[model samples]
Target: MAPIDLNLLTALDALLAERSVTGAARRMGLSVSAMSRTLTRLRTATGDPLLVQAGRSLVPTPYAETLAERVHAVAQEARAVLGPASQAIDPLSLERTFTIRANEGFVALFAPAIITAIQQAAPHVRLRFAPKPDKAATPLRDGMIDLEIGTAGASAPEMRTQLLFRDRFVGVARRDHPLFAGPVTAERYAACAHVAASRRGAWTGPVDEGLHALGLRRRVIAIVPGFLDALAIARQSDLIALVPRSCCHRGGVATEGLQSFDLPVPTPELAICVMWHPRLDADPAHRWLRQKLMALCRMPA
Candidate 1:
């Protein structure tokens, strides 16, 4: 069977509702003769006369009557789907699950605030947090993750990102470690055993480079995949854990019997960001989610 021209549905609806070629033509801004021709085509497509003369006026046939209300509704819905999305969406009615990829430190520091804000605004929305084993764009490209929160690195040019905050590395260890007994010096800091966090399990990075510049070198006894794990190890041992300052609960690393001190060697400050694929940049719900997260992160720390 031949496919029906969907455009004819609008013409058929107008014909059924108006029951006159002249009326439909005026409503749709077409000539009366053009409307008459379109009516003929619509009748041939639907296999129905659709309208018939009744006392010098046209009226819908039984078949056309059956399609009148439903056709109008479908046409209205189609128009809405094609229209601009300038109107804001109602958060209370939003029901969606957003998956975000981030490191353990980011989740520990930001998840609570994000959850609270999402719950208070959109009760039906759910959140799934995925661990970031590495900085890769495959998940975002494949729709596995809705957003990514971490320090932005080399990424595809099409990916979208918004900076959430800045973070700096802080050296953490048991509260009374010998490093705290005196002013922290490059030589003294480099003499201690250190626990380093690297997703790739590398023992040395910019921090080691900076220390080496000062004619000092720290011994890394263990390498961990995340800052929280390094912190866990440092909490009970004499080894120093190098982690982001944001990982410190309540804006300090002193929680859980650990203490944080500024690194004697200069380390680069990191820009934390929320990243997503460009496809979702303008979606109403996605935009709302980004804004809420940004607001929470920008709060005074």
Candidate 2:
């Protein structure tokens, strides 16, 4: 058999993705005739009509559909392999900005350490923290955000994820609050007025469900958009703030003027993960930043 040209893989990937000769031509910067000729070569090479016309638009054959994801991954991997050499990326000399999407509580708890570490190791590099209004994958796909720190619920299947750490909800209140007068119980906890934190403005979650199971319900007097805000409200007032354990504690040190306690009812543990698009898998600097974050989160506090 004659040796196959590696360039054909690039053309085949574009053709399969676009499903149109004209589109493939535009994507690969080739003329329509050239793309059509390339498609002919692809047919002979694969021994299958990768795409077939069904109506106005072209549709992939069963075989072509199976090849789409694999081919796309291969093409992306090749590009990364051919990109700037990994040896050239020295953190101390590198100058680039990476944006991370996360909630204010995580920012308050972890950002200081992360920034300090990065500054000492890579003074020329910069970090940008973006507010995470939702776990939508568009920002990562579009390169608007480099990393996202949060749970992986409903995450895109193709995106890559790494477990950073686990957390649980803990109730907090002002120091010397009335609730501390005796042993805390489910009934007394539910009787207290609460201030809930939810980015979507929801006032109920696992805690409410747990309370319901025991024929109890807490009074939510107000709702805020973030845990940080909820903590502030709890600190100055009598309302209880249920937030992640990490947010109000660092190195076993609780936030001043606030007393933390585990909820009386059982709740699920939160598995926090750092997610990113697969396209950044082979980028050395991105990999470095990811490792740094994972290490920091794993440290005893």
Candidate 3:
């Protein structure tokens, strides 16, 4: 019948996460005895032994495991609700780390610009660019990654996305390759051995579908995990690499020893976007970072 103390929710989240009274105490900046007393209150309030000792380490009980994620979410929402609104953030004074998951093509083409802009505005900020092995939204949901940059895919409905740029695929090969000496026709394009860039090692793509419309198929000699690898192979061999047009510029993987041509078969343009969890929608620091990325990606190459 009594209202619960909101501070207990914060302690509950920390205790469930750490699973150790000492660790939870350190996290909450409380003495061991104080944390022990708080744990007692938690056990009584929930009618469960949230944590139990197993061997030398503490483990969460079944109920605690169920409550862990929910409690953490509640604590975050509480903090966001109570925090200062429209707090002025000085980029020069900001110190934080942001993890972004993107494909190799984006890294090679646009990462340098984004990094330079961030460093100039916030010298203390650190950026960690992670590989996009798959389209799973777990990293974003679990707060492991700050942003995801790539083509639109099946993602959580609650995720926030902003269009960064639009791009189209272009075929690339060694500068002196025979494909460049003559006009690139659908049949000529299909005759050449190609390198497919797919993180899942897929043999087919929109290009293949386009070729199929004209009753033709390209010979895919190799399947690489990313565009950069495909370009690397194309640079040294006769294999043709299909990559985004923007990724073939001076700063990208296709910069040297390679030449690009428009796809002989028409394919859909790619809409590259930056995605984030909605929880960060209102965070000033996150907003600033997103703005910087959008500006950098939209800049004239």
Most lDDT-accurate candidate: 3
Weakest ten-residue segment in model 1 by summed lDDT = 246-255
Q: Per-residue alpha-carbon lDDT of model 2 for 1-301, expressed as tens digits?
A: 8896866888989988888989999999999999889888888999999988888878898999999999889888887876676644788988899999998888888888999999999999899999988878899999999999998664688889999999999999988999999878999999999999988888797798889999999999999998888888898899999988887666223367899998999988999999999999888899999999999987877
Clashing pairs in 2: none
lDDT of 3 at 112: 85
In order of lDDT, best first, we have: 3, 2, 1
Consecutive 10-residue window with the lowest summed lDDT within model 3? 246-255
State in Å the error of residue 77, model 3.
16
> What digit string (tens of lDDT, one per residue) describes model 3 on residues 1-301?
7997988999999898888899999999999999999999999999999999899888999999999999999999998888777657999999999999998778878888899999999999999999878899999999999999978665777899999998898999999999887899999999999999998889987799999999999999799898888889999999999988887863443569888899889999899899999999988999999999999999889
RMSD (Å) of each candidate, 1 decimal: 2.7, 14.4, 13.8
- The alpha-carbon lDDT assigned to residue 211 of candidate 3 equals 95
Clashing pairs in 3: none
lDDT of each: 0.85, 0.88, 0.90
Cα lDDT for residue 152, candidate 1: 68
Tell me the TM-score of model 3. 0.72
